[model samples]
Target: MLITQCQQADVALLEEHLPSPSRTSFHAQRFARQGVGTSTYLVAWLADRPVANAEIRWNGCAATEVRQAVPNCPEINGLSVTEPLRGGGIGTALIRHAERLAVERGVQRIGLGVDDDGNPRAAALYARLGYRPVVRYLDRWSYTAHDGEVHDIEDPCVFLAKELTSAPTPDLGVRVQ
Candidate 1:
C-alpha cells in the first residue's frame, strides 16, 4: 500500500473509496484545507485504490479544551478505514505515516481525540502507540451535509498525545479506558 498526502486531484479517490451520502464534499473540504496549508489529507492507496484516509490538522482538534491542552501539536483527525478492511494494519500504517509527516515538518508532538464513550479499541491502539491522555473534553462540532443542512455532534472524548522526539508531556489524567 502507498500512503500519500492528498492533493486537490485526489478528492475523487477519497469519495470513491468511502462513499457516504451525507458526507458529500467532505473530501473536497479536506483537500481545500490542504491547499491552504492548515492541514494535510492523507490517503492510503492499495492496488490503485484508496483504502483508508486521515487528516492531520496542524492546530489540533476542534474541541476548545483539546486545542488548549495540546497547542501546536498536529492532531490526527478523521481516520477511517472501510468496514470490510478493518484490522488489517491499514489504519495503523496510516497513523504511523502521519506521525512521520509531522516529524518531517519539525513538529515535536502529535495528538488525536478518541471518542471516550464509544471507542475502546481506538483508545487501546493509541495507548499502545505511546499516546497518553492529556485532557478529557466534549467533542462539539458541526458540518454541512450535501444538502447544505448543518448537523451537530457531541461526543465524550479524551485527547491523547505522543512525543515524536522524546519531549514528554506532563501526565494529565488516567489511562485510556
Candidate 2:
C-alpha cells in the first residue's frame, strides 16, 4: 500500500470514488486548483491502483453550522474506499493518513458529516479514529437522485469532530479507544 498526493493524471481516478458532486471532470480540476488551502484531496493507492481517497480542509463559512459549533476546526471533507476494498482496512488507513495531514498543516481539530441511515461506514470508522459527534444539523430539503450528487443529503447531516494536536507534523496520536 502506498499513500500519494494526487496529480492531474489521477483526477479521473479520484472522481470515480467521490460522491456525485465530484463526478464531473472539473470538480477534480477545481479541487486541484486549491492546492492545499482550506481543503485538499488525497488518494490511497494499493499496489499501483487507486483504492481509496480522503479530503482534508479548513472549516469555513460553507460549513456554517459546523463552524458555529467547532470554531476553527479543520475538516475531513470526505473519504471513501472503493466497494471492493471496503472491509480490507483501506478506509481506516486513508483516514489515519488524513489525520497526519491535519496535524502537519497545524490544524488543531477535524470535522466531517455522514448520512443518518448508517449506510456509509465513514461515521463508524471515524468514531474508531477519535472523532465524536459535535453537532447535527437538520437539512429540511429534498433532492432527486441522479448520477453525480456529491455531498450528503440525508435530510439532516450529522456533523462529527475530533480535536487534533497541532504541535507536530505527521502526528497520529489521536485515539478513540
Candidate 3:
C-alpha cells in the first residue's frame, strides 16, 4: 500500500472509493487552506484505491488535556479506515506516516485523543503503536455539516503521546583490512 498526501486529483477518487459521508474532501480542503508543513491529509492506497485516511494538525485542537501535556506537539486526528478493511494495518500505516511527517518538521512528539467510551479498539491500537496515555479529559467541539446543520461533540477522551526519535542507520557487515 502507498501512503500519500491528498492531492486535488485524489479528492474525487476518495469520494468514489471511500464510504459515504466520508470527510476526505473536507480534510483535503483543510489541508489546502492550512498549506503544506502546517497540516496534512493522508490517504492510504491499496492497488490505486483509497482504503484509509488521517490528518495531522500542527496547531493542536480540542483535547485540552493533550495541549496541556504537550503544548507544542502535533495531533493526529480523524483517523479512519474503510469498514470492510479495518484489520489490515491500514490505520497503522497512516499513523506511522503521520509520525514521519512530524519528525520531518522537527517535532519531537506527537499526540492523539481517543474516545474512551466510544472505541476501545482504537485506544488499544494506539497503545500497541507505542503511545502512552497521558491524560483524560472531556472533549468538546462543534462543526457545521454540509447540510447547513451545526453539530456539537462531547466525549470522554484519553490523550496519548509518543516521543519520536531518529532510527539508527543499519550497519552493513563488511571485512575491514
Every candidate's lDDT: 0.80, 0.64, 0.76
- For model 3, what is the error of residue 116's alpha carbon versus the real structure, in angstroms, after optimal superposition? 1.0
**TM-score for each predicted model, relative to the true structure:** 0.86, 0.74, 0.82
RMSD of each: 6.9, 5.4, 6.1
Q: Compared with the true structure, what per-residue lDDT tens digits does model 1 show for residues 1-177?
A: 777878667787777778655655788888888889899988887767888899999867877787788887789998998888888777778778778778778898899989987988888888987899999999887876788898898888889999896333322321111
Give the Cα-based TM-score of candidate 3 against the true structure: 0.82
**What clash count goes with each model?**
0, 6, 0
Off by over 4 Å in 3: 19-25, 34-37, 145-147, 168-177
Model 3 whole-model lDDT (C-alpha atoms): 0.76
Which candidate leads in lDDT?
Answer: 1
* Candidate 2 Cα misplacement greater than 4 A, ranges: 15-23, 26-30, 138-155, 166-177
- Which lDDT value does model 1 have at 144? 69
